[model samples]
Target: MKSKLTTTGSRLNPSQRPAICLGMPLYNQTRFLPQALDSLLAQTYGDFNLFVSDDSTEAGPGQIVNSYAAKDQRIVYHRNEYRRGLIDNWRNCFELAGEMDYFAWVGDHDAWHPRWLESMVQILNTCESVVLVYSQNVNIDNNGGILDKKIKPGISTLGMDNTRRPLVVCRQGQGFGNMVYGLVRARALRQAGVFPRVMWPDVILCIKLALIGDIHQVEEKLWFRRRTDRFSMPRQKRALFASYRPWYFKLPWPLVNAWMLTRSPPALAGSETGPQRNLRFNLAAVYFQRWWSKFGGGSWIGSPHEWRRGKATWIRKLKKFRTAVELKSK
Candidate 1:
């Protein structure tokens, strides 16, 4: 069910709009809410508005935000009358942003380095062509202790024309999702649609952003992503669509992504020349062929090796069963 959005604070005037806007969509994350807010508030760059959209059921999160809002006028708080799934709350942050030159989506549990905003803002201010700027990320446990897992390398589609950008983003295996949290050009992000209701929406957003302009990566690790089961696939599926959904809404990702990719060319294809359009189609075809070879059709059943292995395993089991039966008869 849909709920009315109630604001705890007043909106900003257009003339008073900040240069950067940090849209934070929070749920039931009271445990680390303070840390998350502190990390952003401590940023060296202070000319930004922190808009928080809360979808948590408990009053704990609201209370925390209220306490913080009392101290910081820059922090704007809005709460839903009832819980409205993940994507809506996320989109709400952007909707409340009014107008801004740059925007970033900060997670409720993720913490950032003191200079994160300062560093990212510098790039956006100086680079005319760059639309998004992100940094390397470090994984942290619930206790905020750094995990020893291998950090995925950063990827950049900078300098690649719009035709080649989608191909690179598709081939990118890990760490690309982090780019969604990076500072983005507000206009370009709007054009891409903040968060589309699709499987792997971050991946699609990155591809769309790539088509818009350049994406750059800061070499340093500035973002701390909390590793938690709250991000499990089942939980994500529920959050991606809505709070309530029928079983029929659940569909396999590959088929959905394939269909999404098929439709993407026309929707995102702006005024492109004939050759550019053909090149994009060819690149997408190449990616699909490679994807099939790696994961889609090539790795699954019907392979000769798998068939032989299954036959050998069944034969051994049958022989063992017969020997046991004969021993019992004797």
Candidate 2:
């Protein structure tokens, strides 16, 4: 049977919008989709709407979504006629948020604890100034078995001033970008411009959020991320930008990200102030310096072995920077 979604032809009024929106971008991960949907549907918080945007070439994912939507009206499924790549699918899911108060991007391959939505909603409700709230994560294998790896917690811009927040985010290399999976204020997410067209757009979005409002992290391990190292830069570039030109792969992605950070904030009605604009420029400079140290210094390019070696050096610097930030904050 071919899977399909009955598109809601009419847009809901602002008053009719659900209080919370979970935008889930799905790909061809049919084997894990059931677990992901089960985890989400089991959330104790029942007031939210789950928008699943499928970009899979096969019917498997859509079938899974259809099965779940059959039982849960809260699940609003939308299937693209053609493949839209990863980032575009994410954008499609985000578009489903409309005017919801709180919004979150749920990874189709990831599983959340039953209290994930409940805990995040409580934090967002309590912390009026917080634009995002996330819990700690536990790494899991493809089989859902726990992986024995040390997982670092994401940066929580709790007491930090908005001006200095982006600096912490810019330097919090690698895995810190996972904060995008955390629940975020719909207004703030819109102000951050959702996802930019960059290599690590999630990192850029996090920096933008840092500039707008506070970010909180719950201590409990509520997110279970399926870990796999089968990463291909070219494949990711195609998936992210929906581009396949040879020159596109050669472009300095982090440098491009730096330039994006300098641009004026998204043109959403009430956006960044002059000072925030200046701060974003300063953060861009920080990003440029890091990019140079990684690429210009000949540290991040060369053989695969050299790449691993260069990454280790960057990780060391990240730890040092994080330690300094923690000490200064104290």
Candidate 2 colliding pairs, count: 0
Error of 1 at 245 (Å): 5.4
Q: Which digits, one per residue and each the tens of the lDDT, describe model 2 over residues 1-330? A: 011212223444446544899999988888788889999988987778999998887889889899889999999999888877777788889897677889999988889999988888777765666888888899999988999987764666666666766687677644545688989998888878888766777878887887778777777899999975555554565677544433543677667778788877547435757776678788998887766544432233433443566454466677699999999999
**lDDT by residue for model 1 over 47-76, one digit each (tens)?**
899999988878899899889999999999
Off by over 4 Å in 1: 1-18, 244-251, 262-272, 275-330
Model 2 TM-score on a 0 to 1 scale: 0.81
Name the lDDT of candidate 1.
0.74
Candidate 2 lDDT (Cα, 0 to 1): 0.76
The clash count for each model shown is 0, 0
Q: Which candidate has the highest TM-score of all?
A: 2
Top-lDDT structure, candidate number: 2
- Clash list (residue pairs), candidate 1: none
